[model samples]
Target: MATEALGSQAAAQDRTAGFGRLALTALRAVGRVLGRVFGVVRPVAWVLIAATITLWIAGQSLGWWELTVTAVVIGAALLLCLLFLIGRTAYDVSLDLNRTRVVVGERAVGALTLSNTGTRAILPSRVVLPVGNGRGVFDVHRLSPGEQAEELFAIPTSRRAVVKVGPVSVVRGDPLGLFERVHRRDEPVDLFVHPRTVLFDGQSLGFLRDLEGLPATDLSPDDVSFHALREYQAGDDLRHVHWKSTARTGHIMVRQYEETRRSHFVIGLSTSPADYRDDDEFELAVSVAGSLGLRALRDSQRVEVRVQERALPAATGKQFLDALSGLEHSRARAGGIVELAGSVAASLALASVVVLVCGTKVDANDLRTACSRLPFGARVLAVVVSPAGTAPSLRRIGDADVITVGALEQLPLALRKVLA
Candidate 1:
């Protein structure tokens, strides 16, 4: 085992050495090309040389030291610009980041480390990095031989979702800063922003308990629960005659117990123009629907939701929230509560409770007619999510139960009773 370990270590060392040599070779090659280009500046150096000589010759002999010093200075400047400065080249880049999820208005910081691996030092002019909204822009002025610097910025987010943040660009600039050269790394990172959740203060909802689902009580006509006793009637089934009750009452009594079964609930959303002129009312309706659905789901009841032409196919926790987030005010009038009820009735296996989430109010007569259309004994619940700035109230349309919800958040309670 020891022998094998030694061999692996040696191989790793060789790989590292090979990679370093390859990088160094590339940098050296680039440096040589740059050095050759700087050679053209020899003419500028010569001009400075001639100017210095002429000044000395015009009668500054008394300043021999100054002339000698001037010659030396020109020589040094020319050599440095032509030989050393342009040849300084090294290339290295690295990145560091903080937490992924950040507050919308908070600052996010990141660090970048750049190294010039060549024998010559490199001055990188431009570094472009993508920052989330609200994060101020950052600039890296220069990258010395091996420089690491921190960048400060803020991220501004209005909503919650995932956003991909980028592959940064490393730029090089000429000595005069006239032109910038850029190269990019192929790195894409993602950040998740949670939804903007709001918590209402001091909210009371009594209607939430009447949530619709398969009814848990003995209310259905086809159920088996004992409801009450009544005196025997002409059409009373002989089998249902309560002989024990009759003996006590000295009258022919019959069992009139009500049967209970699963409460069937159908939620229909109306997106008709006759319903709401203000978009807020529509949004409120959507919110009420979401709240109502959640409440019913929590109760372990089977609940179906219907929205005219707005078909949302989400069936999971977060999926529903995401779908609801995309809800918008639609005026297509593709279907109405009455039509939705009919459609739902056709699909249900048993009689169901119908609940309508509508922002617009329809004519009372039409509503009454719609209610009359419902199958016998199938209850109708109309929940109005009105944006009329008034407290909610309840009314009746024929045999149907109608309740108004002032706020979208109060939908759960209002629907519970209406559907229940």
Candidate 2:
């Protein structure tokens, strides 16, 4: 009898567990239904709907005429709103940009095209396009079957940035502003507003003129550029042994060569906002870095441009400029120019020339310290951009030559002095 009682209790518990699971499933289904219902309903409409139901309940329970009348009015208005959202829009939409890349202060033009692809006529509606932080709303007229409408829009390019234009959406709503259904049309496009760069005579630069290879002061035993013969070291290669020099000196000698390094130009721009007196100075520094990078690309030299965060792509002129457009300055969370130099040294160990771009707020001592972190035999040039109206000047701090540029126009002259 005890065994039978235990079995009966287990069966009861199993039935209770199954009932609980069914209850949870029902709740999930109800939630999904409510989610779909609320997707097209605005927040204000939800409040009005709740108020209507409450008033109706209160009026029926307390027999209040005024509350019942108000509830009826709200319910009627909601039903009217539902009538406006009855039809679905079938549209063929496309977004076209005249140019995805522009310079700062230039205008970027784009067009949105919408066609009625349905068998019936469609009512007038509003189309919304998200442009960066702002929104553009175009009133699309009623389109008949096989009819199309086009709208032109311009994006502001007042500053250097990467602006996202679109994921064009068609907005359907009622006149009461209580309901809306948004259908996304096209993929977003990125608009690159590149920094203004100055063109200069790149061939005149001492470090860049060498096309074959630059002969470094450091000596290597198995290099192509022979320097001089030296007494054989313990680990010297046997092939490098100079028999003629050994016969003349009566001792073993080996051929030593100066290390030949392919010209690699690296531009390190500081992204720390504190390094600049203001935003204008930071922008000038960016332009300077861009000018140097473009010149390097023109020279067909291997160029790497980077900030405190990551290296910018420099494969082509357009890519380099596009990456520069999105460059921004922030606080020095990962240290400053010294850390950037270390990173470049690690990534490009054979850099022949390294240029450090910063603002006037960075002192000479800091510039020297930053330059000290570069790879050995790499010639370092530091460009310190100042605010407009200051005269361009050049100075040597430790091994790095620091050029102070006041404006974008002064960059060519400042670089010329460095070459001189």
Candidate 3:
């Protein structure tokens, strides 16, 4: 009897748990259906609906003619709002930009074109285009069948960035802020606002590289620059065997060559926020690095640009500038110039010139320490970008020549004076 009683109690408990799970699933399904149907309704509409229901119930129960009339008026207004949302729209939208790349302080002009494709006309609606953090709203008039309308918008550029400019949305709703329905019509676009750069004579800086790279001291079995003849080793390639030397010396002789220098230029730009005094100083540092890299590229030299996070693409002028336009300062815990130099040294073992771009917060000791981590024969130039209004100056650290640049325009003059 006792065992039967325990079994019955367990059976009842299991049944109750099963019922609870089934009820929860049903409620979830109902909630999702309601969410889909009423998702576009505004909060004020819901409030008005609830008030109408409550007032009608109270008025009918209390025999108050005034309450009943007020409820009817509110209900009529809400019903009229629904008519505004009951339109079918078939639009072919296209977004066109005059140019996708621009320099700082230059406005980016774009046009949003809409055409009515269906047989019926499209009612007047609002079009919203997102440009970076802000948005522009335009009133699109009624577009008849086969009729096209165009709206122009200009995004102001105050800083360097890669601004996302589109995914144009057409909004349909009443003017009373009751209901809204949005349809995405176009794809997004990226507008690159390149950093300001100055052109300087790279050869005047004495960082030139020969067409055929200069020979290094390291000897290799296979290279272009011949160093000397040596006795043939076990793994020596027979193609490099010196027949004349072998015949004269009566021994197996092979040709040895010195490794040629890699004439690539490297730019290490410090991105730590703590290293900069303000946003302007950081921007100046970025511009300084960009100017140096552009000069190197114009000179037809290989360039490798790096920041605290990673190395940027420097294959062409456009790619380099696009990458630089998207750069932002690193977090507080990010490394400084010393760590940046270390990373660049590890990634690129050989370079003709390594330029360190930083702010005035970096001291001489930091520059010296950073210079020690670079390749032995590579020339180091540390460019310190200070706030505006400060005089430009030049000095030499232990192994790196430091140049203080106050503004962007002073970069070319400072580089010529310091490096020449």
Candidate 1 lDDT tens digits, 1-420: 999999999999999999999999999999988875554444545577677677556436666677767766765665554432333323455655565554333434556555555554455345666654422234555555545555544445554345556566665544533334446654755554433222332211222233332334444323355667788778768888889989998999877655443554556777676667577777667666666555455554456666665455435434555555555545555656666556655665354556677765666665666567665656677777676765766788778888887775555455455434
Query: What lDDT is reached at residue 253 by model 3?
Result: 99
What's the ranking of the predictions by lDDT, best on top? 3, 2, 1
Candidate no. 1 TM-score? 0.46
Looking at candidate 3, the ten consecutive residues that score lowest on lDDT are 200-209
Query: What ranking of all candidate models by TM-score puts the best one first?
Result: 3, 2, 1
**Could you tell me which residue pairs clash in candidate 2?**
none
Winner of 2 and 3 under lDDT: 3
Model 2 per-residue lDDT tens digits across residues 1-420 = 999999999999999999999999999999988877788899999899999999999999999999999999999999998887766577899899999998888899989999998899888788999999999999988899999999998887888999988888888889998998777897999999999888887542435465548788888878888899889879889999999989999999999899889878888999987788999988888888888888888888888887886889999999999888888875568667778888888887888889999887787778888898888888889988887688999999888888887889998888778877
Against the hidden reference, what TM-scores do the models get?
0.46, 0.88, 0.88
Hey, what RMSD does candidate 3 come out at?
Answer: 5.1
Candidate 3 residue pairs in backbone clash: none
Please list the residue runs of candidate 2 whose C-alpha ends up more than 4 Å from where it truly belongs after superposition. Answer: 1-33, 204-206, 230-254
